[model samples]
Target: MALITRGFGGRRRDDPNLPPGQYRTDDFPVLSAGPTPRISLDDWELAVVTESGERSTWSWAEFTALPADEPTVDIHCVTHWSKFGTRWRGVSLDTLLADVETAAEYVVAHSYGGYTTNIPLEDLLDGQAWVAYEFDGEPLVPAHGGPARLLVPHLYFWKSAKWLRALELRLDDEPGFWETAGYHNYGDPWREQRYQAD
Candidate 1:
């Protein structure tokens, strides 16, 4: 499968954050399903759309200008590698959506190049998720979802869609590109939800 690229990072087996069937990697890896989209800051904008089609927008400057939080968390990829102690700086998804209201129970995170992923709206709240722009104190790189990306570390990395643009709230769950193709709908790393049994 084009999506499965495994790298063993020689991490300790005792690390509790390392999910089952995962190895620790100190170095970040670059994996993408499509060509890297170069979104100039001038043209970059993040939109939030409710199930009823209500939309709220945040431009590049406006997004970065918000009060930022630095989250230290571990990142796990479905490919079997996990990065521990990964630090990021960005506005919490809660902070971004504070002024917006939605009755939706789920979310479809859409990105450039038509990449999308499904995430539970509840999983994104209460400081669990962020629209991260900087990683390790550097502006995110395109290959690694630079400029901006959704950070949902509780799930597989793919759910944290790269090159993120809009988040569409939904009352029902729908599979995104990878999920529909083969990956699990709700990717919990600890449970090893890489693919649902066929």
Candidate 2:
């Protein structure tokens, strides 16, 4: 098990009143991209390529059998509205990173529906990030990025890329779906990179 720091700041359970379930700021615009995309994966279809170009693919059953742990964390979106104390379950990113060797400096997290996000490899291997397959003690729902999702608590929620499918380690920085459309390349929540600035 990887040791993670308890808190880093953003949202807290004691914060002002907010409804349960995931909540984002008006700035995010509800992502009107229509219904969520689905990409089925059997045990043989799951793959992970390390920055060093090593590859490991797992079947659905194999992945599901891996050790999973629950973590309660706060989520902050670049748009606004911090959600606190959300529970998630999945293997820690550190565990996954340990299995692969990477010399890349960054990662492009790809998803179905062509959505993707660029994140630094250092941020992902730092041990706080996770591949969350469950939320609130239950299997994640489709609208909320079911099956699996990336959770990077420190950065803006966009960096948490939902409907997560693959992690492509890159030797250099590359903008992703939203980043290409004017979102900030780094997307720090405290910096508030909700939209493109003049």
Candidate 3:
């Protein structure tokens, strides 16, 4: 649901296409908490670890072999920028978590460079999220979360952790790097849930 905030003003407004306090931008802005980490495809792997300690992993080749989907979604950042019609090719989170057994309701998406973001498990299942390896028809560049990144377009972009490596299932909802630092625990863009207070 798109929201309307009467007094909010900043970026270019596209009321029908953006969340409450966002403006449309054609350029994909790069925002990272730290230096981008360089990772080689040969060493790239995605692991799904359950709360019971069981683990499942997929190498680069194995991961790419799974079914892929091309999704064109509009992404909203907490910083107030919204990019529409962004195209991506990726393996759905459903495919990644299919064979794994878990009753956990939360997950912590871990990245190669120590970045982590907590997300509700429900938000990742079905067709809600992806482990995207391509952006705009090309292999994702490091500055934009190369190799692969979690694509949860429904939420704030930060929940879509870049350089995604592992998903750790949790019985409890734990605050990740940004969540602990003041970002909302569940970043629903339409709600303008950028910070915890929202």
Candidate 4:
């Protein structure tokens, strides 16, 4: 039996800003591989581990103290939904990796509740990504990767890991949770890379 979802297979709006096969939606959908993690602000920390085993740790206060950037970007998901002009504020990856010494070319974002996702190092640099704590001028809620989440707008929303915890720099790319489960190793919505075959 084929299941039909409302507004999923309905009429298509002519929006050139949206990627191919994606429908623009005002609603921010909540999708997760597991239950939402309830991490306290006081207990939150972000770790950046270099390939050489060097580690830089930042408490919640220290992270929030860093310079932040406000970005209005379009986010696309693997499920064919695109949200445009979303406002976010957070510390850029350049700011985070500026002092960290590394020769790695890739990063695997580790998140709370054991969710993981891999992204190229270059994709995270040059103001391409951020560890976002606020959405739409308000503090993010747990259902939306609360304390902080990796915001990589260029790629599929899955690449923007939720509930970001630690980021491990790697010399070579390693497939993370979704990648290992038949999802594309690198999810680029523009390319429609959703499954392993993509």
User: In lDDT terms, which candidate is top?
Assistant: 3
- lDDT (C-alpha) at residue 59 in model 1: 90
Ranked by TM-score from best down, the candidates are 3, 4, 1, 2
Candidate 4: segments with Cα more than 4 A from true spot: 1-14
Report residue 140 deviation for candidate 4 (angstroms): 0.7
Q: lDDT per model, in order? A: 0.91, 0.72, 0.94, 0.93
Which lDDT value does model 1 have at 38? 94
Q: Which ten residues in a row are the worst by lDDT in model 4?
A: 6-15
Ten-residue region with minimum lDDT total, candidate 2: 19-28
Specify the poorest-scoring 10-residue window by lDDT in model 3: 6-15
lDDT, candidate 3, equals: 0.94
Error of 3 at 100 (Å): 1.1
Model 2: per-residue Cα lDDT over 22-141, one tens digit each: 353433234424578665654224456766677776566777788877888777765456667778998777877676766788889887667889988888876678888888778876
Question: Between candidates 2 and 4, which one is better according to TM-score?
Answer: 4
Q: List, residue by residue over 1-198, the lDDT tens digit for candidate 3.
A: 989875555333536778888888999999999999999999999999999999999999999999999999999999999999999999999988888889999999999999999999999988999999999899999999989999999999999999999999999999999999999999999999999998
Question: Which of 3 and 4 is ahead in lDDT?
Answer: 3
Error of 2 at 137 (Å): 0.9
